[model samples]
Target: MKDTDESIELSKRMIQTGELCGKTTTAFITRMDHPIGNAVGNWLEVLECINVMKSGKGPKDLVNLCLVQAAQMLIQCGAVPSGTLKEGIIMARENLSNGKAYGKFREMVVSQGGDLRCIDKPEDYPRAQFKADVIATSKGFISDINALEIGHIGVMIGAGRNCSEDAIDATAGIWFHRKVGDRVEASDAIATVYTEREETLNSAADSVFQAFSFSEVPVEPEPLITNFVTKDGVSNFSMSIFED
Candidate 1:
């Protein structure tokens, strides 16, 4: 068989094995084409997630995107009522707003022997002393943010590791001041990168600039949820899935 055919057959075999083992496999898809948020290090990422939950304000696109994927997965797995998906989202939003999500996150952190105090004071977390801003060159709305590029920038800046032995700065990361649909002016600071080393910060800043794009006209809001799929078939249950 050809290389592509062999590869396809191997994947099918793996899927069959998974099904035989009574394990359900579902794919959740979304694009973070831009940086996920302000945090990068493992601990710092957790802290950022906690802050998101506490503030009840997350990247609206990111949260809704994940929920739409998850709800579809649940329906595929026969885990919950299709009509309850909206309720699930409302519950999730409320949980985050009421700090329940943050509390749960803290419990997980403490259980794992991580320092919990940093959650309250992100500044207490070690920070990359050097920083720089990425300025927009044109006036327009941010049309796209590339996730992979941002991740690459993080690795270049010491926020992530290139090799298994490489060290990651827990506090190093890029922060975005702008999101999709937000208007930006020329020379406006769109994002900031933090790094322990000056050289690394410069490299990261360059990557950040390359990762962003702007258009004169605003881009249509991308649906947080795309198409929901089940064993039976695909469903266009975007808003309905959330109507609890």
Candidate 2:
């Protein structure tokens, strides 16, 4: 919501439309400077989410972002009292750990005619024929992993569509070992990319390597959630309750 004028206008219009129908509307505005979690493709991202839901363990940033969004949703929907945002977060974490979240996901997959065998045992899923590691050239702290560049690389590796007619490869995607602000030694595997096309492997790996920027000094990671937008106004921090 904070990115562009068009998005801001659209958000305001959405809230206004909801108001006309006597509904409440709000949005959690998060930064998109880098990929949310380690995985950035269809199957790889699903596996990451499954691991998080099943074990309540995954990337710290991804977990926190999900919890915060879930808490806000609970508050807005009145499933929990507006003032109990922290409680909502705790409840979400409990659901993740207690298998309820994974259960729901499994149910949804079955209902949608998706094959549960692959999700249940991800190892059985077909592997990418080609794989390459993006190694660090110098020892330093990672200052940036440009999200735009990474997204382009995703398309190049067939993880995403280049055009409306382009087909996606479920096994093609990237797994990051080191993200922003992580220290790396020379020749360390910062990330690994996978794809079915052997010819595209080297170019994709080179692009992924170029997407990373390094600094000799430590870099502060940017905040994931930057603002909260509602019918009332925008705020820098998320609020537990919004007075109507």
Candidate 3:
């Protein structure tokens, strides 16, 4: 809801049309609080998703975000009870941990003619020819990571395509080493940039570093979930719950 006009309008239109979402079919609405995980680019996202599926432990915030979204999706679809969110989370975790999630991913890959070798051994997937770590300059908490600028860095590195005609390098991306509310030192690795080409590495490094902000004061990160908009009304999450 914070990002797209079309999404807001689509929800409104659905309600106006006949309350099809909440009444006929359940609709779960949520927005990404950050880049959505530890990975901030194309191939990086794929690898991150796979790691989460295989291990059930990658980034805590990402794992929970996915589990919460899945739980809510099940509840709204009536497959799970409204009171069973916690249980639903457990179920989702089981699916992720027990190879159920990877099975679906593999099926999709085969359907699309993607290399089975990569799916079987994703660690052997294409890696950046060059890599660099972005280290923090001070001892403090990560106050912010600019989501948009980080995305632009991916585009600059060719992980993201500028237009439909622009070819994207599936191997290029950045991996977050620290996130908001996390502590860091004078030289803690906050992120890693990956790309095959050296031409864009330096500038991309600058953008990646500039994208983060640090502070000595403690920081309370924004909620991954802001609210739930349903047929009845919006149920807002209290921001006070996170305040220090």
Q: Candidate 2, which ten residues in sequence have the lowest lDDT sum?
A: 235-244
Residue lDDT tens for model 1, 25-110:
43322334445555555655666676677787767665665555545455556665554666556656666678877788789889
Pull out the clashing pairs in model 1. Answer: 33-145, 33-146, 33-147, 34-145, 34-147, 86-241, 86-242, 86-243
Q: Give lDDT tens digits, candidate 2, residues 47-104.
A: 9998898888889789888988887777877777545768788777788889998999
Q: What's the residue-level lDDT of 65 in candidate 3?
A: 70
List where candidate 2 sits over 4 angstroms from the true fold: 1-6, 19-23, 238-244
CA error at residue 135 for candidate 1, angstroms:
1.4
Expressed as tens digits, the lDDT of each residue in 1-244 for candidate 3 is 4564555556656755556433543343555546667887777888888878877788866787778778767676777755466767777778888989888888999999888788678787768899988988889988888888887888888888789999888899999988888899998888999998799898888788898888899998866765555556556544342232
- How many angstroms is residue 221 displaced in model 3 relative to the true structure, after the best TM-score fit? 1.4
Stretches of model 1 off by over 4 angstroms after superposition: 1-19, 23-25, 38-44, 66-83, 224-244
Candidate 2 residue pairs in clash (backbone atoms < 3 Å): none
Q: Which pairs of residues clash in candidate 3, taking residues 3 or more apart in a chain or in different chains?
A: none
